[model samples]
Structures are given as C-alpha cells and as structure tokens.
Target: MPVRGGDLHVGVWEPEGGGPAPPTVLAVHGITASHVGWAELARQLPGVRIVAPDLRGRGRSRDLPAPYGMPTHADDVAAVLDHLGAGPVVVVGHSMGGFVSLVLADRHPDTVSSLVLVDGGMPLLPPPGVAPDEMAGLVLGPAAERLQMTFPSRAAYRDFWREHPALGPGWTDLTTAYVDYDLVGAEPELRPATRVAALGEDIRELVDGDSVQHALDHLRRPATWLVAPRGLMDEVPPLYPDAARDLWTVRYPAVRMVPVEDVNHYTVIMLAEGAAQVRPHVVEALGEAR
Candidate 1:
C-alpha cells in the first residue's frame, strides 16, 4: 500500500494470472466504508485489475481536515486514478462513493469512461430544512458519524454484530474487517480515523443542492444506477406513491435501475449477497463502454 498526495493510500488486490491491463475497475467505498466494502465484488471479478483505495479519512488513507466535502473527495479519487496512470477506467462507487463518482463525471469527465453507481449515485431526498447541518446525520447514517472502530477483540465486535442476525446470511468477515480497519487513538480505546465534522461535510455535499441533480435522462454516457430494492431512505415516504415521483422513475432515463430483491441499503452493495447479480451488470456496463 502506497500513499499518494499525502492523503490517499492505495491498496490493490491483484488478480492471479492477470496482468495490469485487465479492464481496470476502481472500487470506491461508501460514506464510512473503506476499500474493503468492495471485497465481494473484487473477489468475483477475478481477471480484472481491482483498484481499491482507502478514501480520505477512512481506511489506510489519512483523514483530511474538517469540512472535507464532495469536491475534495471527487478530486481525491481523480488523483488516485491519475496515480494509477491517468486512466479512462470504469468508476464503481457505492453509497457516498457514488456521489463522488457523479461529481467526478461532472468535474473530470474524461478520466472516468463509465460510471457504476452501487445503491447510490443520484441526489437523494434532502432533509426538509435548507441547512446542510440538519441533514448531516440523516445523510451519513450511523457509519459516517462513527465510521471506524477497532474492538478490543474481533470476537467482541463479532458479538456486537450478532445482535442483528438478519445480516449473517450475506455478510461475513469482510464486514467485521471493515469496521476494525480504522484504528485510531491508543490501542485499547481505538476510534474512527475520520472526524465527525468531515463526515458532516460528506453528507452536506450530497444534500447541498442542484449540483448533483443534473438532467440524468440526457447525461449521454454509459452510466447505471444499481440499487437494492429498498435502499437507505432518509425520509419516510410511500414505496410507490405520488411523493416518490421525484425518484428514479420521473428522472434519469439513461440511468438503469436494478431493483435487487431481498436487499437493503447497507447489504445491497456492502454485503456479499448482491454480488452475484450486481457484478455482472456492472461488468457489462464496463464492457459496453470500454
């Protein structure tokens, strides 16, 4: 693992018997998640070169100072890609990662040849208030605020996760490894590497405004929106009601939505279950564009 720009650390899982030019796939994790979030997808895509970098303030990467908003993150990814040799590769971003990918498209369109938004890419419903502070917690979710934690014992963390048996089916040790990757403070009392303020900025960028809400229908690129049927929702709206009109249906015609069955916000892209179906679609997108 090597650090670039003194901010991001690149950790790659090289595919066996595969050389460097295997249609590179850059895997950007969600809000709190690091590169490990895409372990399942990396494992499935055996031949391709999997480039997974720890986003700023998350895994192996050093956290930026407070007020680290979306632009900073998008620039960070662009730097990582440039470090990987100024690529025109596929960008697959999950959760908050998708937001960054969209920003990358808007900011550095040439670098990113195709976009694969895992469970997130478009602008989600904002918090009613006009203030970014109000939407910070709601947008980031539990992971953002307390993004990382190193437990005294992995078993202790495992036990903590056992409280919710529902996830046991799809998620395995990767989820556990992801939480423990961010080690901060003294050994016994480790904390998440990122600051809450920085996490807030990430959320703030997402709900900030019309910056991300481009006319998706005519964006003119091989971009796909792959979401779990019932992904993370900040607001309480009907499943298919009039108010939901502002969702995927009304806008983003070019955006292909794969309503993955038996998946939710966290597990859709983070967990292993969605990989079988999701990976092919994304790989296909990369192929279509490449």
Candidate 2:
C-alpha cells in the first residue's frame, strides 16, 4: 500500500472459511522483524482480520528510505488503517512496535480504540553515559550483529537461528518461516531484510525521544502490557525485571501489566504457547473497543 513516504508492504490474514466481516486488529511487528512475526498470534484469532505491515525499512519495505522514527512509523500505520477503511481498530504491537502503537494512538486517536503492548512501550532508560549506538547494541545484541553479517544460504541462516539461545529450542515451522523471510540478497551474501541505518534511527528515537513518554502520559484508551519473563537473549532476568516492573506498575497504573510465563522476548508472540496466553487479552481489548 502506498503511504506518504513510499509503498508499504502489509500482510493480511483472515479466518479459514471466512464469514461476515469480523473485527480488525492492526498488528505491528518489532523493529527488526516483519509482518510475518505476527503469524502465530494471527492464527490464535480465528475470526478476526489481522493487518500487519513491514514498517518502512524492514521486511519487503526495506527499500523505503530514511527519515524513520516512531512518529513517521505512526503515520505509515495510520495510512494503512485509512486505506483499508479499518476504523477504530484494536492495536497490538510487540517490542519496539509497542512504542509505535502508543504513538499511533496518540497521533490518530480516531484510528485506534485500544492498545496491547507486548514486552515494550515502557521507557527503557539507559544507564548514565550510554550513547545511542551503544544503547542499540546493548538492546539488540546478536540481532544487530546479524544485520551486518552475511549468510551462505537460507539453511545457513536457519542454522544461525538454530544456535540462538532464545529461539533454538522454541523453533517451529511458523518461527522458521518468520526467520527465513528475513533473509534477502543473493546466495552466499544473504542478509537480513532490515536496513541498518533505518534501524539505528529508530533505536535512537525510541531510546532518546520523549514522544513515547509523553504519549503514555496522556493515554486515554484502555491498554494492557504483556511482559515476558526472559530477556532478548533468554537470560534469567527479563527486560522488565522485577524492580523495573514494580516501578512501572506504580508509575503507570492505568496500563495493566500481565506477566506471561515460560517465554522469552521473541517467543512471547511468535510461538503457540505464548499466543495462547495473549489471545484472551486481545479478545478482552477488542470487546472493550466494541
């Protein structure tokens, strides 16, 4: 779909044996991920239409140029909703996409009726003296490293993920497809379908920009934040550690936080078990919107 900047790539999924038009949900993927990341979650919502976009500079939209940030991403998503005539839809965002959803609701309230933030949205303040690039490295870790490296073939790419501490054991066909779709370029030089420059700009804005903080401050819609117990590397302490979760719960009392068990940052929405946990919250949010 053509938006203000460029043609955006979107993935739409509807229930099998489709019936009357069901409620739509605008699902957004993480910074490095594409619309395919929402595949598992979409399957869980059997009767709903799930519209997910390859946010500019990621996935098939990788050719979309710079000037990327949360606000620009919000506009792109709004354009998609408008083009589809999807009004007041429930917005679901995972990881950095969660931050974008908050901006979407704030920028175009009429297009969003509620928000579901999965493992993101809350401010992740860097420790003193942490630069933007360093922050990106710290948060993204191997994901950032993979973007700069090349794979010999799709199988090689799969092997790379097969060794990832977080995704190795949790691997499934759906997850495999999601990771395989991320590979681009010719064989022996295949790289992830993510623009390093655009990713850097997005991370800079997300970590340094005050827009997300401001948006959450005045959020009017009902929002639920689902937190994974493990971090990006499948470590013991998750991104939102106990102390951090406690602080956020008290600070942003309106945004209810629910802890999802037995999942890391990546699997929270990309696996069947995690999707089962998230399904009810999405249903409840859609119900509230109705």
Residue pair clashes in candidate 2: none
TM-score of 1: 0.83
lDDT of 2 by residue, 1-290 (tens): 99766799999998777887789999999989999999999888989999999999999999887788899899999999999999899999999999999999999999999999999888776655877557788888778888999999999999999998888898899978998999889999999999998888888766657779778888988899999999899997787888778888998999999999999999999989899898999999888888
lDDT of 1 at 229: 58
Off by over 4 Å in 2: 127-133
Candidate 2: C-alpha RMSD after superposition: 1.4
> What's the distance in Å from true for residue 92, model 2?
0.6
- Among these predictions, the greatest lDDT belongs to 2
Instruction: Give the top-scoring candidate (TM-score).
Output: 2
Instruction: Indicate the residue-level lDDT of 187 in model 2.
Output: 97
Q: Give one digit per residue, the lDDT tens place, for model 1 in 1-290.
A: 33334667776778779775667887777776677767778878887777877777666674554445566677778887777784787888887788778877777787778888876666666545646566655544555534455566545555655554334445477777765665566646666656556565567656544446652433645777775655344222312223333466556666666666666666766566777767887678677766
Error (Å) of candidate 1 at residue 28 is 1.2
- Whole-model Cα lDDT of every candidate shown, in order: 0.66, 0.89
CA RMSD of all predictions: 3.6, 1.4
Model 1 lDDT, full chain set? 0.66
